[model samples]
Target: MKNKYLTLLFGLLLAASSCNDWLNVDSKTILTDEDISQYPELLETQFLSSYDDLRGCIQAIGDGAFSYRQHHLSSFTDDAANNTPWDAGVMSINISPGRVFASIFSQSKGEILTPVWPYKEINKVNKFILQNKDSENSEVQSLVGEAYFIRAYMYFEMVKRYGGVPLYSGSLDHINSINDRATEEASWDYICNCLDSAIVLLPETQKVATEDRDRANRYTALALKSRAMLYAGTIAKYGKVINNGLQGVRADAARDYLIKAADAASQIIQENKYSLSSEFGDLFNGKDEDNNEIIFRFSNVAKTGRQVFHDYWNMPYRVKKAGYTAFMSPVLDIVEQFEKLDGTIQPLDYSAKFSDPADFFAGRDKRLDATIIYPGGEFMGERYSIYRETRVKTASGTKVYAYSNQEDWTNADKVPGHESYMMSGYDGIFPNTSGGGFTNYGFYLKKTLYAVKQLEDYLSAENEQDAVIIRYGEVILNYAEAAIELATSYGETKYLAEAQTAFDQLRDIHGGLPSKTMTIDVVRHERRIDLLYEGFRYWDLKRWRIGTEMHNKQFDALHPILNIDETQSPTAIYYTIERVSAPDYLITRTKWFQERDYYCPVPTDQSPGITQNDGWN
Candidate 1:
């Protein structure tokens, strides 16, 4: 196996180095550079390999602060609570003030906290672009366009995390000659320019194969531009420039960037190439891959062994065969963000008692059902029973009892009189129980979890749900946001009508709720709900300059308590909701997001003469 791999690597190196040189060899493993170059189709084999690194940007599981790793971005924000007690880095370690202050942002060494890994991936993309940009073959030109999109996407990811990262236009020849960090404005400009080039060279769609739908097209580049420019525009409008523009954009440039974002999104909408999926849940349940809403997705086909473990880590406890489940528990703070069917925003009435706990979530936006699993919610054909405790009516008053484990319900010493009665639900939120398969926040994330029963084994990683990178729903929201920002922030009302139309389409068509007046706040709320668990919440808060307000506070969760009526014939049950801090132990301290956190601290020691973002030093 070692010799076979070595020969394959040697053949690839020779083919890439010298396309004309031929070596006469009889071994089937030895294919000379001249032999492989004869087939233009074989070039695709090399071009497709670049996506391995690009896919890392959206990988569901890994170790990193940048992408959706074990600590998903949603956990770091107010959107969700992470239940992994063994790994408290997301709450206790990663968000610490000392950790951020002492962070080493070298482009080469240190932990995976910084966006250093993307640069290594970018080098491969740059080399591909330099070699294939001028190819006469149209197929190869489209591949080159994809290369540009990959580079732009990586830079956008970097700039959002650490403003004004070092931009490499081509492959680096030496490790010592790294360029100085570009200004934040210049970095965004470079990203937009790359997308523009991609738009010009890419075809509207790949007609060769059905699987090519996952590949980048003209609309895919535009979708990214629309999203990226909105981030730049928000930073310019809300954040302040510092360190001679290395950290923030100019305030005056906000309107232009927003207009560019609106224009790019408008083109995608007007082209009529995509539409919202009829069923919102079908988009992520692996039931509808042909859905037109997905502009670009990371395809995870089970037959090919390129799959994800979303179901293994996120399915409800009753359905899971192993321990790793409910890794991301949706906090009540975000669950209430989903509006009612009538479009009214009402906070859940925790003070009110109810006959059924699921009634607390009644008449809410349909997307809530698709996105989260609450008490009495059905997932994978199993109804969830998420009560935390039981309250029994006694001669004196109501007696309260809590079960520590699943077996305590049947143990006489644990509950005594409740031995005949089920003390807690099978999926109960028990206290003092740490780790996965337990719901710390009394809810489980249903979005992105594959719904197939055959893939329910938590020990297996063979779940086949493609990660949607860029979808039309996000584009609609982006268009609405940029247009509304233009009208409200700059007094430019010409785009207001179109913005309202786009906003209403998303709400009425996908959310199944009425649309409200278009305001920056309304658009933001809709974006949060529509794009929840898609890994956009953290950056959205930072770019909107609301991280300090949203963080540095304890997020709340719902505790469902079942009230038993023994006097009734069949013993009726009622529920009461109590609000408490989510994962009180793991989230020991309030999550803090300082102003300096808007842009990560870059290391000046490794790169000489490079200016650090203000407040880091």
Candidate 2:
């Protein structure tokens, strides 16, 4: 087995080094210097390989399953929940140092705890940049620029976790030269510089079907730049409590990073190359391709390409032939965050209008409906019903009412002009009943999900749905955040109104919210509503230095229970909010966020002097 693994790895390296008889390098391996210098065209293939791996290919390489880069983080945070208690269980808090350390080990240790120490991907990117840096060919130079963006992106992912990490942009070698960690500020500066170089060389618009959709273009670099700068600025400004990991940027640096964030986003805004599309549901549902709102996304081909796991994510068990236990249900606590549609600062409660059963989903911010499938809400011609078996005696006859598949009552309780049956006779909680992993918190996520007629291939990663990494909606929020921060702290008069203007774009995209203060909390709130299941909530909480606050609390899950009295003229249905874990099923679940969690433990197997984040061993 060891020999076979070595042989496969050797073949991959050889394929990257030299071309075959057909003058095409093997698709399995990446670009090598010999391949890049001898055949400059191979650089494009190698450069794009970084993206392909991060998108669809990373799933197959790292874990046995096709795990996404961002999916794991979503489970740890309050935004989403994974059913199996591996990491998402409410009981698993204060992660053991042994377990936490196991995940942060360097790549050379024969295991990867996380994507932070990505040596293979970086090696290819550095080789391309170094070999093609002096090339006079326009395309080769452009590839080099893209390589810069990729390296910068790699660094941002690393720095966010490890604070200060080793930097590399040149060719790999006998490595005594580049093992030292730079400060957090230095790493971010390097990321910004890479984007600055990319913006200078890459084209403005993605050429229709070819370069624009799959690869990063000029705007792609800017969009990421805006994203990183905003993060740096927030870390600089608000991250005061956990001070051990960050390498001490000056106070002014926070304002400077915010300025860069606002400016970088402003360039994209001024260019008008992208627009906030109103078709929120259709855009993510795979109905529209290369829409105007998407600044950058992974384009996956149907059967030939690797697939994603959107079908199994937060989908209701009611789907025909359901195998995926709804492990990833959207918790009800976050659902109420949506503002009322009347443009008022009212909590999202539809009980008053519950007289109209259909009104359960109406009148709230439309994004809620687009993202979450609540009990009694309709989607894909199927309504997700979470009601109990209700036995009622109508004036005419005895009947049992279920939200779905209503049945006739039996063993009725004799009454005057009315009849009733025991609720225990029928199956209760149509979809919320936990079986095969289907304990939903009364809601399912519809953001990354698409409705399909047949789901036999659903469990397999056979999905061709594109994984969206960054879009204009986030950039707009970033712009709004930076502007709002600068205006509040520094009293920047010019940005006070500009913040409102930028925020208004998102408002119009998802039916406008009522007038509200453009405070940082409000900006943070808007970000959660728009980017809920996209795996940004966890990072947003961390960057805002509010992880501990969120971790200390438990999320509430609502169960829609319907109770009907046969004696009453009309039946009454009630929705009850309850803890997801039943009285006996509860396993002491909690999220005990500590200061050390701010920075993941540094890989001990790396440099000797590399320190762990403040707390861990």
lDDT of 2 at 402: 42
lDDT by residue (tens digit), candidate 2, 439-505: 4355666776766444565555544666567788888889889989999897765655766776876
lDDT of each: 0.73, 0.61
Count of clashes, each model: 1, 5
Q: What are the RMSDs of all candidates, in order?
A: 5.2, 6.8
* Cα lDDT of model 1 by residue, 1-617, tens digit: 54554555557657543221111111122233443366555556656766766765543233342233345557667888666655344345445562322231223244434333355567667877877787787888998899899889878867886788788887553445344888999999999999999999999988565755678899999999999999999999999898888889999999999999999999998899999875898798777877989888776755335554445556665666556566667888888889989999888887777786788898999899999999878787777888787888865677777777545633523344666535665676775344547687888888877775555343355566777778999999999999999998898777778778878988987788987998888999999999888878877888999988955688787888888867666767688888886655655224667777888767444356667678767
TM-score, prediction 1: 0.89
Measured on C-alpha atoms, candidate 1 has an lDDT of 0.73
